[model samples]
Target: MSELSKQLQQLQREIKKLQRAGTVPAAASAGDESKVRFTAKGFVSLRSKLGLSAREMALLLDVSLQTIYNWEAQKSAPRAEQVKAIAQLRGIGKKQAKARIAEIEAAQA
Candidate 1:
């Protein structure tokens, strides 16, 4: 790869690490928040990737079901702290996400 490509990959890794660490910057604007890789379309895509319903995703993320809908509708963005949960979602697959949902539900019960 070109040096620029290598640098971009490195930067992406650092950003992912920070995100998983819940160190995303405070929300600025809807557009700016998209920089955190949590855009409405991406959110929808990720939820679909996990094969999760809005309610299940809300449970996993510890947010209200409506919040999940709002996110996918671009009505709002996840707060910085909430982005940590989304980051976790990015690291997991359909099975893992379902397992996580089960864990969260068990804990709630």
Candidate 2:
């Protein structure tokens, strides 16, 4: 097999092991519903699942547009704060944590 094919095969095996151990979400048996695959490399399967553009992701992430471009191009890695924000947007953080939480609460009341 070609190097890329071998790499993909390896990744598939690793993903299967993770699924068996309940560490990763397995692909849907029906192949209709999208699955979120969280690998150890911090490359969540958000791009394929959400179909969001880089600019949209940057806006959701509250980071600079250039930052997103840099990340996509591998010119830079996400800083700690950016990583946290991404995790939050990905529904991995405390839901109530928001930049304008106080304002939102006041408006609701």
Per-prediction backbone clash count: 0, 0
Best by lDDT: 1
- TM-score of each candidate structure, all chains considered together: 0.66, 0.41
TM-score of model 2 (CA atoms): 0.41
In candidate 2, what are the lDDT values of residues 4-75, reduced to their tens digit?
999988988887787566454333312333233323235335533455556556656667778777776667
Q: What's model 1's lDDT at 41? A: 83
The root-mean-square deviation over C-alpha atoms between each candidate and the true structure, in angstroms, is 8.0, 13.4
Q: What's model 1's TM-score?
A: 0.66
Model 2 scores a C-alpha lDDT of 0.53
Clashing pairs in 2: none
Once superposed on the true structure, which residue ranges of model 1 sit more than 4 Å away at CA? 1-35
